[model samples]
Structures are given as C-alpha cells and as structure tokens.
Target: MSDRLRVPSSVSAARTGAPFIPRVLSIAGSDPSGGAGIQADLKSISANGGFGMAALTALTAQNTQGVRDVHVPPVSFLRAQLEALAVDIQIDAVKIGMLANEDVIVEVGRWLAEVRPEVVVIDPVMVATSGDRLLDPAAEDALRRLLPLAHLVTPNLRELAVLTGREIGEEWDAALDAAEQLSLDLGTAVLVKGGHLAGAHTPDALVDAARALRQEFPGSRIDTTHTHGTGCSLSSALATRRASGEDWPTAVASARAWLRESLEAADELQVGSGSGPVHHFAGLWARGSVMTRPQAEQLASDWWEIIRPIRDGIDELPFIRALADGTLAHAPFVFYLAQDALYLREYARVLAEAARIAPTSEEQAFWAGSAQGAIAGELELHASWLTPAQGITAETFAAAQAPATTAYLDHLRATAFDGDYAVLIAALLPCFWLYSDLGERLHAGAFGEYARDPEHPYASWLATYADPAFAESTQQAIAFVAQAAASASPEMRERMLRAFTAASQHELAFFAAPLTVAL
Candidate 1:
C-alpha cells in the first residue's frame, strides 16, 4: 500500500497532498456482454487507479453464456480514435485487448509507433474462458507485429499454446521456457497466466526480458462462474501500473494482485448470469493497512515539480508561512481555509464511497473516519491559524474569496452530477496538501521572520505535519488501500484504481481550475 505516496508523514510530523492519478488508453473491441472486450478494459482501467480512455476496434454481441457475434470496425475508424487521443490528452499507457482482425491490429500497431508511448500491454485474446475464439485466424500475425512494440504481453494458457505452438503441458518450467522463447522472439516481456493450470490457487508468471527477470504470482483461485473478462481486466490493470511509472515487472506484479481480488469476489453476488463479471470498484475502502512513506515522497516529487514554484506569487504576504509562525496577519489564512473547506465538502463523499464498497466493515470504518478527519481537521487548522489576525473574523474570511470561492463553486457544480464517491475524492485531493506544502517550503530556514506575530502560525502548522503519529496514520491508510488492490482478483482491484484515478485527476483539475468550471 502506498498511502504514504499520497500523504506522507515527515516522521516528525504528518504530510498530505493532492493525489496521483494515472491515465491510460484501451484499444480493443467492445463486448455487449460488458464482461470482456473494450468494456472490460475500460472498467478494469478505472478499477486499477488509472483514468481509462478507449478506441474501439470491434463490437461484439455477447453475453455471459458466450460471445455471439463480433463485428470488426474498419481500420480507418480505429486509427481515427487513436490519433484524436494522442493529439489531445497524453495517453500514458496503452492496453490492447481484442483486435478482431489483422487490419485492426495493424492500425493499432501503426498508432503505437506514431505515439511512441512508454508502456504498451498486449493481451493476446484468442479463446475465451468459455472456449470460444475472438480474434480472426490472421490475428496472430498482427499480434506478432505489435508484440515487439509492447512492453508486456499477457496471454492465457490456451492463447499461450496457440502463440507458442505447444500443447498445454504438465510442467511449469515448460511453460516458462515457452514464455521465455516468445519473449525472446517477440522482444517484449510476457506474462503466461496460469489460471487454467489445474491448481488449488492461481499462479501467474512474468518474464522480464530487459533483465531476464522472472517472477511468479500466487493468487486465490476463486470458485465461481462469474469469471468473465479477467484477461481484459488484467491487461488494463497492468497498463495503469505502468502508466503510474512502475517498472514492467512491478506493474505486472501489482496487476496480478489486483486480479485475484476481483476474481475471488466476482461471485460476491451476481452481476449477470453464466460467467458473471468481477467487481472492479473495491479499493475505495482499503482496510486499515499501513504503507511505506517513501512512496508518498515519490509522488510528492511530481506535485512539487508542477506547482510549488508558481505559488509564492499567489500573494506577496507568504500568508501560509506567516500564519505558521503565529504572525498576526489573519486575512489571507481565513480565506484559504474557507475555500479549502468548501472543497473538502466534496472530498467527504469520496471517503463515504471508500467506506461503502469495502468488503469488510473495518475497512469501511477507516474510509468513513478519514472523510470526517480530512474535512474537519483541515477546517480546524484554518481557524486556529486565522484566529489572531488583528480584527480578523470568520465572517471576514467568508468575504475574502473570489478566485478561490469561484473555483470551489465551479467544482461543486461539475461534480454535482457524479454520484461516485471515489471520483469526488479524486477531485478534492489537491486542496488539502498543496497549500500546506507551499507554506512549509516558504518558511524553510526563515521561521523567525514572523516571530513577533502571535497570530502568525508556522511552527504549529509544521508541528501538525511533523507529528510521527500522524505520518504513521497516513501511511497506514495508504497501505490499506494498496492491500485492497493487492489482495483482490486483478479486475476488481483494477476498477478501484480507475476510481482512484478519477479522484486523483479531479484533484489535478482543481488546481488547474479550468475556466469552464468542471466542478
């Protein structure tokens, strides 16, 4: 769990920040069954902590029983979507699930070459769990064409057999050798999924071609008919991890962990009949696990890179650092707090969602508590820091914002229609830590500058973040969320990540504060 990645504690104090959201693109077919194909890919992408965008290659009339009919889209249309996405939003990573025909695959390959994305995951889909072929006979050639361009290729046993021209065998080493051969020949990492390998538990193997890295993942073999779309889910999850800047092997490892939870819990209830779909939105309430603080530090590195430099110009007062030192100037601090409070109102909803979908009550409680704490804690910090400004009052604070309040209102209106809690939280993350980080830095080595002002508050605010207990608590929360993904079937965990991404992006947007008002 990388809770520390989002909100790290300074060991002596606790820290918080906006959030890290990964973005991904899925180029594949659509499954009307909504279990497999591009549908599953999108769902999996969201579940796995990345925002998912899709370019459809084919459309399938399918159901839990089996895929009925798949209509392949023209290569031109597929290319169009790919170009549009590449030219506009940055496509962090790409997950290619089901390219119905060779032409489609060719177009996808061409797009990849043009875009030159850093991470590409190819899930060779030939046979379904129900033993039906999805790709055309010529699809293999297309897969080979794109394989060298991929960072990783995920193929199930049947597809592995088809790709390697080997029978499904009894030896694990044989499979490893085959996967290794394919990796060597194709020049890309490969993951030979062992879900069908007749075992009490599921085992997935990842071959790291770059360093000849080999790793095995042991996951729960969930017993249920609700196991549709697992491959699409895994590929999307892998892509998300990669887009988040994880190495190829680490991305696959995390993807495998997320897949297990989704599979095991697919039958938690029923989404459809026959082979039902897995639950992809399970990471909102990661049970109370603690994560390493280093991950938080890593994420902050990016945040600081983007915004801190521009902040000093927001106001000449260095209101944040001044307030931390107990300086008497209260006007700006109160305004900042009010804007933040309004923003946190939305954050609470996400925490509520995190609490709601958790498989267990304890995890739910954690989310619930976090929601309350973030909104209230931040509010209290504002008041405490603003209390001493000469003649400053809460009413005065309310009057201070036009830029901040307008920003908050626009965010509110935009998110008003979004019912998902995870999305809301993603949107609100930036408000919490950006200012704090700014304050901490501005006061660095100059804490005594505002010493004469009792109302100015530097040490107190710094003390709050510097608390070891607070930092530990933040880390614990992060770890729990990671565990939620790690312990689940790949699909469910992936969906949760998508939700996480949506929430994170929203936070990014909050700061970007689009003129259009995305709320």
Candidate 2:
C-alpha cells in the first residue's frame, strides 16, 4: 500500500512499456463441475491478480460427484490451440494440467519446448478428486518426459508417489523424500503438498532438484470439504505470482495463503452439491462498495465508527479525564512517560521488521523512516523527563513496565513476526490513529481544563500528537492500511479489522494503567 506500490491504472499500463497485465495461460482440460481443471485455473489466476487465458485439451461431462464422460480433442487441433495462442498473445506463464492422452501430452510438450515461456507450472493431474482417472495410463511416460520442461511441478501426495515410483506413507517425511528424488531426477523444482495427510497442518515443501534449495511452508489445515480444485488453484496462483515478479518461495507462500482463504470461503458459493469451488473473488465481495466511496478511502472513517464504543469508553476513563484537566499528579504522568519510552524502543523494532518484509521500496522506506521518527521524535519527548541532561541510557529510562504496556507490545511483536503483512500494518495503525485523534480533540480544548492554556505543564506533550506533520503521517498510515484491506481476501480483511480493534482496546488499557499505579 505504499505510494510506490500503487497499481497503475489500466490506462497507465497501456501507456507504459511494462506489460498491461501479467498474462497467464492455463493449458488444461475443461471441468463441467467448474471446480477443477481450466475453469478453476482461470479463477485462481484472476484471483491472484493476473490475466488468464486457457486452451482446452479435453472436455469432461462431470459434476461435483464424479466424471461421467470424457472426449479428447484431436491431437492436431490441440497443437493448433497452443500454436494459435503462442503466436497471437504474449504469455507470461503457463499452467499445464490433465492431458488426456500421450498424443496430447507430446503435442503440448512440443509447443512448450518450442516457445519456452518464462514461467511454466505443471500440475501433473493424473487423477481427479472424485477418484476418476484423468490422464491415460499410457500417457504417464510421456508426462514423465515432460517434467523437465516445467520450472515447477506441483504434485499432491498420491501424484508424488506415482511420479517417484514409491509408496507414500502417512508421515509427511515420505512425501519430502520423494519430492527430493523427483526434483533431482527431473532437474526442476517440486512442490510436495501434504493436504491429504491426516494432520492439523497443511505443510508443503518446495525442493529445487539441481540446487538442493528446500523451503517449507507450514499452514494450519482449513477444515473444509470444498477443496475440489486445490492443486489446480495452487499451481495457477503460483504461476501468476511468478509472472508478476515474485521469487519461487515468495510466490509459493502467497499462492498457498490465497488458496487457503478461498478454501475457507468456498462454502459460501453454491456452485455444486458435493465439494464446491473456492470463491475466487471473496476479497472483492467481502469489501463491498462503502457508500459511494471506494473501500480504501472509507477505511479510516469506517474503523472510527466501528470502534466508537471503545473510543467512547476510553474518553470516559479517569486517567484520560485527569490528564485533560491537568489534575493528574506529576508522579503518575512521569511513570507513564517512562513506560512509554520503554514501549517506543520495542515499537521501533517492529516497524523496522515491517520495513524489511514490505513488498515495495516506497513502503519499505516509509516504515523505516517511521521507526526512526518514533525513537528520535516521540521518545525524545519522553526522554526530556526520564533522562539526565547529559544523555539517555537503559539504566536511566528503565522502570517497572506496566502489564498493559507489555501485553500491547507483545501483540504487535507477534503480528510483526508471524502475522500477515496486512494484519501487521493494521496492528501498528491504532497507535498512530487513536493518539492523533485524542490529541486533536484535546488541542481543541474539548472537555479539557488546561489544554488551551499556554502555561499548561503537558501542553508541549499534547502538541506533539496534534502537530500537522504527525497528523499527516497518521493519515498516510490509515490510507495504506485501508488500501491493503480493500485488496485483501475477505478472511484477511477480517483479520486486519480484528488486529485493529484489539490494538485499539489495548490503547485504552495503556492509558488506564497509569491511573491504577500507586503514586
């Protein structure tokens, strides 16, 4: 959501030398069920931000229950489809799935060898989720020969076992070993998926056959039966992300995360009776138009209204009242400032971590500069009271940090380290937003005795938050978070809101803690 990360408008894309869109080609069969094969592939590609194109290999008269019939296209026509697309369009990536026969596989593989698209993801779909054979057994050898052509091949446990000529045990170790073997033999990266394994986690590993680079992506298994097109979706999403300029590991991680969200939201769609398809546009649906304005523009206003009760409660707290009236004792205020200084030290590190993982350079710079600003600007205000005139140090600033302070900082640290980037930004937002809101209100002398007075002791402190520069920074943070929420999946947008609301509640606790301390 950085200024640099702003997506070019479609007009801008057309004017620029860069591609107007990442064009993904799904070279797979048709799924009448709309839950697998090319249907699902196109959905996955579009959901992950790409332009999707498909060349049908075959047609299946199937539903959620199972495949009823199949008709393979003539090999000559199949080659025509591939050639037509290769010659006419710019293909950024290709996802190959469910070739019905050896002739089909050889034809597509020949096109692949000829064109050599920059990114190729082959799903190796041998069997359907309904226990129907998709690829002809005679084509298995042809598929094996085709493996080396792909940049990455995604095979579920059953497919992995077949490809490697090994029995897949229930333990995930078997899949990992088989993936390593397959990668080395084929000279391509292999993503060994363990979604079928009876476990609490859906753990997957990406193994580079030639390089021996292995990265494990661990995610809690989403308890849903509507995972019909998971493999097709994963491979297509991976290809799309790669086409959009993500590294192998990052692309895989992002694809998996998006697929899981789609899985969780799959039940909402009434596409079929058995396992339904994942809702590709769940993000767009959940973030419906907010009045007449765009979702991102409405974010700050929406969140403020959503947490109105919490804000009301905070305004009613004794600590806030006393501070506004200048009736708060000097000792508790000093104690609060010391704990704040301690909190800022840790807060700065979390911001730095955010900067490290930000997808865009502008976002990275914004977060990095914010970290420095926190320590050099806000902490400096606290240091004026806590430190000696000479300088500040750990010994001088250290105090018995309040439990509220510890809890809030721990939540942010956890988000910074483990949560999604959008969620982390949401967690960091309340500190900027709520403080700015309260400071602006106090500066207006709203329910405050000495805020408007020139001689008020904490006037300078309140002024820092109300400063125009600080308000501008807070607005930028809000805009970034809102833009992210607008684009994120429904589940992720909810997570962002939860993080925001939880942090807002903690802000209330942070202020109240000083009132309870014995002066």
Highest lDDT against the true fold, candidate: 2
Q: Please report, as a residue range, the 10-residue window in candidate 2 with the lowest summed lDDT.
A: 1-10
Per-residue C-alpha lDDT of model 2 across residues 116-202, encoded as one tens digit per residue: 787888999885554555566779989999988888999988888889989985678888989999988887889999888887987
Query: Could you give me the TM-score of model 1 versus the true structure?
Result: 0.53
> After aligning candidate 1 to the native by TM-score, how far in Å is the CA of 197 from where it should be?
0.8
lDDT of 2 at 329: 85
Runs of candidate 2 with Cα error greater than 4 angstroms are 1-20, 130-133, 288-519
C-alpha TM-score for every candidate = 0.53, 0.54
Q: Which candidate leads in TM-score?
A: 2
What does candidate 1 score in Cα RMSD to the true structure? 20.1
Please, what is the whole-model Cα lDDT of each candidate in the order they appear? 0.64, 0.85
